[model samples]
Target chain A: MQYIHPKAIKVWRIHGMISAAISFVLFLVLMLLGLFLFRWLLYLAAGFLVIGLVDFLIFVSVIPILRWRFFRYRINETHVVIRDGIWFVKHTVIPMARIQFVEAEQGPLLRAYRLAKLKISTATSTHHIPALSIGQAQKLRDRLAAFIQASDVDV
Target chain B: MKRAHPLSIFAGFFKELKQLLLPIIIGALFGIRHDDGMSEWFALFGIGICLFFAVIEWWRTRYQVLEDQLYVKIGTIFMKERFIRFERIQSLHLSTNPFLKLFGLVRLEVHTAGGEDKAEFALPAVKRDEALRLQERIGGSNRSSQEDLLAVLDRSENSERVYRLRGGELVLAALTSSGARVIFLGLFTLLGQIGELWDRVSFITPLRREFHRVIGVPLLEAAAGVAAVLLIFWLLSSAIAFVKMYRFTLTVREKDWVIRRGFFEQTEQIVPFKRVQAVKIRENWLKQSFGYASVYLDVAGGQAGDGASEVLLYPLIRKERVAEFLAAIRSPFPWAVPTAAVSIRAFYWKIIKYVVPLAVLATILSLWVPYGAWSWLLVAASMALSWLGYRDASFAVDGDRVALGRREFSKETILTERKRLQFLSCRVSPVQKRLKLMTVQSGLIAGNNGYSFRICDLPLAEGRRLYEWYITAYTRSARRELQRVDGESSYSL
Candidate 1:
């Protein structure tokens, strides 16, 4: 079993920061409305500011660190096991025989950081290994693909 | 590999008309309500256009069975095409409703293992002999061998009777089933609509008005009226269920399971042994009390006609006799039923999840409401229910099979083979982690919604072990089956 790349913490923090930015903009709009339109709505503006602060502290700062600390995955001869989450930890196991396909996806932010996400698909659902280095994602995908192919060949 | 029977055009037209029926009725209701002639005429015009298009679709549609695939092309403007491999075809169902039976034709519904929302392809109406030929062709080598086995079984002196729901048992089953509630709700809605449309002469509106007039009290009279209506609806629904589930019989053959059911429209569903994905045993409140249960099978890519779900194994069986029923069905998994109890601490969790907040809210409500004591009763009942729920929850794994048991108002135990599981997941909340607990959820590939089951608040370590064991066993069995299939497919190639 191994943890995902250390950079996943940074990626998660970046994701949280983006959410915080959106919330901050929303707070600004509410504050403007409170100042210019309705005085009673100033209470709403204050609540919005508090929520934004909490979002930054929890989602951007503390949560990602906890997630990175706990997240782990392992692949064996028969199945792939994934364990992750901060509030609700999940452990998912997909049998090698059930692996329908595997792919590596690089988003703009991930591409900028030279990271890729590996998605393993089965008959019903897809699981992801987030924030792997581009090369690592490619290598892992190839290895899993090879295992699936070899298993199929044996069958 | 030919055009369907000429009667298909009539079937296709009626099928399209059936879909249009709802909207047309709704439009007519609005027209009647508003006293508008234009809307009614518009609905009529819409029906005319739909009929015209349906005829066009029937004329253009064509299907052919090629070497390895059944190809179907339909529609003109939409121009849809489907190419389904023969091996992927899971079941070929031959069904004849009254309309089709009149012409000695049956609808051939072809289903595949792709798990789509709709059937892979349906030939609306085909001759019985032609449907049999198509079924044989699509099935190929396996069908012939299975037919030979069936022949042998037929020649045997005595054929085993697997399970049968007699008339009395079926009535009991229907009374306990959700079918009664569903029917009641459906009819109630229909009556409500009619009442709305014809407020002056309506049956319900006048009865309701008379009740209000006679009682002069709104709430009390309303309650009495509802009770009366519900009683009537229950009886009506029971009759409907009796008709729908009459003569339900499940028989075992050498290589298949045959489910014969229905009174007015006798339907025969044949599921080959290899196609069976999962089995379930369910008991509602009444059924549980009577020690009776219903069993359902998840057959891969199988579809039941008239939009009903997969038919039950017998609709009624003694709870203690479930093992015999499973054995009679020739389930492949080991027979031992070893249960792993959910942690006792789950009681507290259930209380926190269901009872505590509701109780708090009820207490607050008691401060304002005149009948404050009633709130206490509700809170007490909820607390008792939560405690009962904790006592009933358990999960077990025996060899290649997993059984998840849970109770809300009803107790349901779903038994599925490891290889049938399409997905399995284990979740541990922060609270659960502190309690050393987790929840395991699983889904099968059989139903349109993908029948899923969950076992909550199990030991985290045990949950992980179950996940590992399930995946490993599932993969090993799947590989063995695949190897055998691969060898046979190679020979064909």
Candidate 2:
């Protein structure tokens, strides 16, 4: 098993923070609405404020480290095996012969970090590996494509 | 080169009118609101335009049957032509309702694969004989050898009838089908109506009094009402099933299988062996108790039936005779080995997984809602089903065939060949890791786009073995000779 690029932790923190920010902003709007427009929203908004604060603290300080520590993946001649997910720890095995397509994607954030996400698709399911070094991702893409003979693929 | 039957003119006119109906209605309404006497003429003009287009289209559209393909030409100007190779044609469907039947006409549709609700080619109206001739011509390309035809015909065609619905089983199948929701709803409605019936008919005179006197007890009255409703639904559903599957017969000749059935609207479906992806044997709770199951096939090509994905093969059969039926049809997939069972500990896990959340919901409902105490019944039901799931769910690998037996409200047995499977996977969580348990899943391309079979709560080593078995080609054939489907077996038809 191989760990993802260490920069993934940074990506994870930013991703988490962006979501947490949305909730915190929603809390602020709810508080403002409760103060001016509706009476019942005051208690709900106060509860949301506490939730938003806890979410901010957890995403920035706790989740990214745990996610990075747990994520592992492996690619071999016959199958691509991945062990992921925070709580349930889903393990997936996709046979190379069944792979329909392989793709690599990079957003502006990932581009800044020189990282990419590798997506592997089978006839019925899709799997993704987030935040791999771009060179490594490209090498993997090419190798998997080369190994998957057109004659071997089946729907 | 030829044009469709003359009735196509009417079909085209109706089709064009349907598409243009809304605009014409709106236009006529505008005229009427303004108190214009010309609205009638405008409507007539719209109809005339539709008729004119229909005539032009019918006259221009022509089809030329070639040696091995069908070429269709459409439109006078800006003409578009399409060539559909006979070899690529997957299935032929011919159908007619009462109106078409009165005119001895049927709608013919030729199909291949991939598109939804769109056939490769369609002739909206054609004489029944011509449609049959075209079907024979196009379908013959699959097994075209004259010698093969002679060989199949030389033997008895009746012997080729692999399976047919018996009179009793046809009714039995309808009775046990998944109309359970309707049954509960009907029962509740009938119960609600009993009080209303007593109140309304209390003063309606002798008929109500006479009926009440004959039945006497209110309990008996309720029971009779329930029985009457059940009987009516049973007969109604059975009548529907009978109309569709009357005299259902599956006949095999070489590698192709043909299904012919129906009472009022006859249907024929031809499925080539290579197109079958998997076979499913479904036994719902009711059917399981009755020792009956229905067999369905996941066919890959052709928009075959009422646009349904799974094709009904055997609508009803004794669960034990499924193997015999498969053998009779010479199916590539044969049921053989008994599937292994998950451990008792898996039941505990299943109960925890399903019942815990349901129990919490039930508690909250009981605390807050007036009638929420009944929610505990749901929890009890979930617990029982989970136990059944643990007792039944498992997987097996024999030669090139893999079998998955699972229970989720119903027990379904999915059997498929290795070459048809898209992929395989195994998964585990932290709890499963401690318990040394895993779930195995496999995918196959089906008419429903795709279907994945999941076998939950297998021993960790067993799940790994099933996963490894899919990728390991060398070991697959080691026990090939021992496969049950290998030897030719004879059974009473």
Candidate 3:
């Protein structure tokens, strides 16, 4: 098993911060609306603001580090195994013969960090290995395509 | 290379009419209710458009049987052409409805191994002899004569009556089946439509009032009426099942297996042995005790009644004779072997996973309802069911066949050939990891829908063995076949 790209922590942190900022803006709007609508809602707005701060602190500061540490994947001749998730950890094994295709994608943020995501698609489900170096993603894609071609023969 | 039967124009008209039936009926109803001439004109315009398109479609559609493939050119404007290789055709069927029969024509339906709905190419109306010839060509091309001859010789000398379900047996099968429950639900929806019509029609109001007055207690009478209607519907559904599966017979011919069944609509499904994906034996609670089970063939893209994926090999038979029946069918998949039952710890795990949370939710829900204690019976029943399910679950991987027996008021033993499986995987939940258990999920290509089977809470060692068995056995067979072909020096024209 290999861990995802180290820059995943920073990527996840930025994602979490962006969502947290949106929540904070929503909270500020709610507080301002409460001032015009009702007095009790003002206290509710204050409570929401406090909850948002705590949520942001945990999501941006704590979860990304844990997730980056835990996410791992392995590719073998016959199957691809992915292990991830925080509380109820999920382990998925997709047979190589079943994979329809493999794709490498890069969002603007990921491209900025020289990272790409590898998606392995099968008939039933698709599994993704997030935050891998572009070179590794391309190699993985080629290897998987070769595996599929080799497996499809004679069966 | 030829055009479809000339009468296909009418077939196309009827096909289009079936799609527009509901809208046309609604349009007519609105026209009548509003006393408006506009709706009638709109409907006339719609019908004209449908007829014009149907004729154009009939004119545009053309099918040709090339040396290696079936080519279809359809669509007047787009002019789309599709070529289906003979090797990829899983099933070729010739069917006739009353309209087609009047013109001595049959619809030739070609289904491919690709289970997409659009994968089917139907030549709406073709001469019966031409369709039969095409069926022979496709079936013959799917497997060479030499290989089929070898397999046919391996069986018993008699290629006579393979299996036939008795009328009593068919009736028993229908009586015990739970399929009528779905039919009953469908009927309820249909009745709801009628109820809406009853509400809308003013003439029925007085009749309803009179009926309620005569019934004394209207509510209880209505409930009784519903119960009576349901009983009648159930009987009707059973009769339909009987008609649909009447004289269900499997005959082993020289070249392929022939399945003949149906009462109102006699259907003959000819399946080449090579195209079969799996053989499944199912036993309901009653049937299990009676030692009777039903057998179905998972032929890739085989179209059965209502577009179902499997063709019934035998509607009902003694479980003890399943091995004999399978052998008679010359199915490549081996007979099932009873494997170890699911782990006992899984009993507790299932209880925790399903029962506990459901019980909590039910209890909280009962608080809002007037009579909540009755919900405890449901919780108890569910817990007992899960325990029974855990106790009954079993799996085995023997040679080329992987058999999974699961219980849900019945036992379904699925025996799939390793070569036919689309995907296989084993997973472990955190709780299962602690308990040294795993669940294996496997998918098979069967029709347009996703067909998957799962075996939960097996010992980790057994799960690993199953995985390795699949990988090694599948690859070894592939390599051996390749080597055999290479060694044969396949020099062909």
Top model number, lDDT? 2
Q: After superposition, how far is residue B62 of candidate 3 from its true place, in Å?
A: 5.3
| Model 1 chain B weakest lDDT span, ten residues long | B484-493
Index of the highest-DockQ prediction? 1
Question: B365 in model 1: Cα distance from truth in Å?
Answer: 6.2
Per-residue lDDT over B1-493 for candidate 1, one digit per residue giving the tens place of the 0 to 100 score:
3778778877877777877865665454334444555766776787787777767766777898788888898765888888888877765666667888898888777765544646767888888777767766776834533343233223342446656787689889878776335544754654575345335423456677788789878556545655665665566567667877888877777766677777756666665556566666777666777888888776554454433445466688888888986786786442334377667788888788878988888888889865454567557867876776666667678766677677655666767666567567899888888888778877665544345567777777777778777766646566666556544211011
Total clashing pairs in model 2: 0
Q: Chain A of candidate 1: what's the TM-score? A: 0.89
Q: Quote the TM-score that chain A achieves in each candidate.
A: 0.89, 0.89, 0.89
Candidate 3 displacement at residue B331 in angstroms: 2.4
Instruction: Name every residue pair that clashes in candidate 1.
Output: none
DockQ score of the complex predicted as candidate 1: 0.41
Q: Rank the candidates by DockQ, best first.
A: 1, 2, 3
DockQ metric for all predictions: 0.41, 0.35, 0.27
The number of the candidate with the highest TM-score is 1
Better lDDT candidate (1, 2)? 2
